[model samples]
Target chain A: MTTAQHLAEQWPGERPEAARRLLLAAVDSFSSRGFHATTTRDIATAAGMSPAALYIHYPSKAALLAEISRHGHATTLALVEQAVAGEGDPRARMRELVEQFTAWHARGHTVGRIVNYELRALPEADFAEVAELRRRIEEAVKQLIEEGVAADLFSVAETRTAARAVTSLGIDVARWYNERSSESPEQLGSRYGDLVLRMLGAQVD
Target chain B: MTTAQHLAEQWPGERPEAARRLLLAAVDSFSSRGFHATTTRDIATAAGMSPAALYIHYPSKAALLAEISRHGHATTLALVEQAVAGEGDPRARMRELVEQFTAWHARGHTVGRIVNYELRALPEADFAEVAELRRRIEEAVKQLIEEGVAADLFSVAETRTAARAVTSLGIDVARWYNERSSESPEQLGSRYGDLVLRMLGAQVD
Candidate 1:
């Protein structure tokens, strides 16, 4: 009955195949020519369809942006949930999250650009979906920090700030990371996890 | 002299006052509408000048992008130099650098978008300028980490990774930072610095 409940119902069956193709086209066009420079025709051409046909899947360029943005949030949230739900100590949980995160970004590199830089192109309604998901992610990390605080495992005075810093640091890896770089995902993840733990004032053992 | 050196000598002037209005226009259009979406007409309209008249001031859109990017990098390198130069200790210097970085991004929020997100849009030559400055910045942080390592004030085994992590964290703050957030610029700066230092294994005093 609630708005959230209604939206939750819609998310599951949102034309997955059509949405995926449309999103892929949007990402390719936007990342190459950028959001402002890219036209509906570009996306349509990339999708091997007409602009009108594209509209059946996405209402507008903004809608296409929102679709990609939503996908970004959904993908990250699923991975984080899987990483955090398993049994492990707080430190171990953090390492698992980082490893999963690095791998996700490594595998879905274009999604990084969609999530981080292209938000401005989204219409207001579409932007809210990504923002809400990003907030959920922030809350998840903040909850972990709160748990650490409750147990006196970390020395952070402000769990909120620590959560932002930790999350931001990991999220940023998506921006600059290149598989061509010398560090493997596992190596990068371990090293990043070590530093993230230290950022929390936790022992990195 | 080499062609690169000749090109350097033939480089356009850096008169801050002369290009202030044009640069401001570029930043606004670039961030709001994006690089490719924006046109000389948009910029000229914003500056109340003819597009052709604007050309007399700068060579091309690519040239303007390069100059803005060049200025951004120069400002960053200079700030880090000043922040860490003749400093008390590595911890203090890192804090100073973080604080300065957060403030700079806050103040330059418009230009910040183009500086952080325009790498893919940059022509090969322009990218080199930005990349060179980015390298200098990483080296600056690396120097600080090495100093801390030499003093046994921080962990030594992963100084290179630590340096990358620290630089990446600060560079990334520009990407998602919203001034509307509850945290003030200084507060975010101090908190981010704390995390950066922790990641470096810096001893808190």
Candidate 2:
């Protein structure tokens, strides 16, 4: 699928078509212009709706941002959790996790930018909610690394720091990845997977 | 020094005091609220100047952002170049480079965020200028890695991708580092230095 289609599919499928449209528009505006700079009117206009209609679906611009932030965080967390749950040795799992996680960030970079960089603009409660999801995401990666250490599959001085560094490689992709990038998301993710495995001291093919 | 003081000194020392204060204030406001949301008035109020006073120093909000972006990028480039030019083998230089670069991001995260994450808000010409500096920064890192590979001190399938991943580790520190973080900037940098060495397949001490 195209980048636009990938971003459009990020919102929950259960939401009404209009709500999804507004959410997609908010992602575009929030990622491009940032949450603090984007107005509800801009979102409404981008979605081809009136401001009153936007208000009916989402109470305010902050509300739109809150929903987008929650969905993005929750979706990524689910993907990571699934990667962790998959059947593999720690080395194999780490490779899959990094590859898919990095690819997700590259493919959905617009929403990734909003969810990762725009958290400060979120309301206090919304910020806390997203932070909890982030913590879980970090925990999932840490668990994978710890398992690797226990099984003698990896070596690291600090597992927590190692996991954070691993996630950092993928999360920052959102900041820099674009159409002009040299590699496809899959190719980038695959290369990162190799580097991450080496960082973990796992044998690389 | 305190984080605030560290951020304050990021502006060039040769500029007038008033301009420095305004630039510091702009960094605070722009980093927290983002470039598009922050106004000349907000920056002026933060700097204890009137909007007219701010305009006297900076013609517009975008100009303030441009100056801040240019200064931040140039300072980082100079530091990285200095590390590259210093005495040591490629392995030693890479270790020192990652340690210092990571700490710089952690210490001056506010300005780091503006330079790394807020580039989209810059005007066309200003963005191009900053992009040129970023290209050079990447080249410096790539050159170091190339040297390591030439000396058989490091093994990597792609030098450019490795360089990007190495910088990614440091640049993303700005996104997540805070007072609440367990590691000091120095400690974080040191740990990352180790992880990066392993990632580069260099012998760890």
Estimated TM-score for each candidate:
0.88, 0.97
For this target, which candidate reaches the highest TM-score against the unseen true structure?
2
Tell how far residue B141 is off in model 2, in angstroms. 0.4
Pairs of colliding residues, candidate 2: none
Off by over 4 Å in 1: A1-19, A203-205, B1-18
True contacts reproduced, candidate 1: 0.95
Give the per-residue lDDT of model 1 (tens digit) for B19-132.
666777787788888888888778877877898878888878777788778988888889888987956887888789878877666555556678877877788988987898
Instruction: Single out the weakest 10-residue window by summed lDDT for candidate 2 chain B.
Output: B3-12
* DockQ of each two-chain model: 0.69, 0.89
Residue A59 in model 1: lDDT: 78
Clashing residue pairs, backbone N/CA/C < 3 A, model 1: none
Per-model chain A TM: 0.85, 0.96
**So what's the TM-score on candidate 1?**
0.88
Most accurate candidate by lDDT: 2
Top candidate by DockQ: 2
Q: Please, what are the lDDT tens digits per residue for candidate 2 over residues B1-205?
A: 5767896667547888999999889888887788888888999999999999998888898898889889889988998999899898988999999999999999988788888887877889999999999999999999999999998899889999999999888999999998789999999999999899889999544
lDDT of 1 by residue, A1-69 (tens): 332232233345556666656667777787778888888989998978899888887778888777767
